[model samples]
Target: MTGKKRKRIKIGDVYAIPLPNGKYAFGRIFKDAGIGIYKYIGVSIDDIPRVEEYQFIVGVYEYVLKSGVWTFVKYRPFKSDDEAFPPPSCIVDNISGEFSIYHKGEIRSATKLECEGLEVAAVWADNHIIDRIMGVDKWHKDDEK
Candidate 1:
């Protein structure tokens, strides 16, 4: 028999393992045995009991140049899906100049702002959404500083 090497698995990496029932089990590699085997924790995406529905108002902000003055305007508030998560504040894509909102690991909304000479911005979700994306509670503490 020819011996073939398998790719190494890392911790926190999601992977699929074949089961005896001819089905695949999706899980995350939690621990490594240093050998070829790895300890995996099963993940059931459809088994999540219930996710609380959260509603928030989002305001899109943009800078409009009228005459020779630049003004910032806060657009009307709009409702966002619970899955819409903002990108990290530090991750700014300079190439596309596009901002995206993600839902279920996919882009739900994308907007290309005109940033040639004007400051184009949008109010992402409320404080809760910002905190969830940033993985921090700084939004609530912003008032203290």
Candidate 2:
């Protein structure tokens, strides 16, 4: 696969990710999953800030960040089957194994490096949650049936 240098994304960076329905979700980086074979791209839920409420629904994405003043970076999906036990497709020395985020970026990147796991650890400790909108369902669950 073609690889590029991975960019370290910060909060406020805009991004776009594909939805299962063929649509796409866009938002800013609420959290970052330090460098690794893969990375997490956390986006804030429309009206929510906490990560607990809606995180399980959208889950973390495996992706690559694009270059330039673009929030909507193109990315590939980490096959749904890989969701259960996500191992880094390709990890750099300065990163973690269980990276988490809302979107995917950095599938194959050269800019990969190690990151401070403290920030991410704190977010997880808070049980970060994103609130759901009145009309939009964060995700589909079998219980909905």
Candidate 3:
């Protein structure tokens, strides 16, 4: 509500994530409610850098975006159909310590073994996710919740 309201977020829109250390990070909306966070750690680059400059570190459902925590940088469409992205359908809740698979508009419970070898989904927390990006905090398999 503070800054100018943006229209409904569309996929492929890149955004600037301002970090506290005076550095900046970048993320792109890849799908419904998900953004592929790039690997920038503490880089001081301000504007959205070229894709070759950073790699896709992780894909997450970032709630911060809904809260308007990021500024719209630019729209970068996927190069090809294969470029469309999102993590696995399996989501592991950090607060409830539950795992579920969202498929075909249905949500089903999943066991730890069922989620093995899959890119388990995660919701991006604000600073906590920033810590993860900065290599301070980490998400280990044992840390699954």
**Could you tell which candidate, 1 or 3, scores higher by TM-score?**
3
Q: Score residue 138 of candidate 2 by CA lDDT.
A: 39
**Candidate 1: how large is its RMSD?**
20.9
Model 1 alpha-carbon drift over 4 Å, by segment? 1-8, 31-145
- Measured against the true structure, the TM-scores of the candidates, in listed sequence, are 0.18, 0.24, 0.63
> So what's the TM-score on candidate 1?
0.18
Q: Which scores better on TM-score, 2 or 3?
A: 3
Cα lDDT of model 2 by residue, 85-145, tens digit: 3223333343554433322343343232433321222221111121221134334455388
Deviation (Å) of 99 in candidate 3 = 7.9
- Among these predicted structures, which one has the highest TM-score? 3
Ranking by TM-score: 3, 2, 1
Tell me the lDDT of candidate 3: 0.64
Residue-by-residue lDDT tens digits, candidate 1, 52-89: 22222222111111111211111112145332332222
Using alpha carbons, what is the TM-score of model 2?
0.24
Cα lDDT of model 3 by residue, 73-122, tens digit: 67778876445555456778889978887643467899877777665554
Task: Assess the local accuracy of residue 7 in candidate 1 as a C-alpha lDDT between 0 and 100.
Answer: 39
- Candidates 2 and 3, the one with greater lDDT: 3
* Colliding pairs, model 1: none
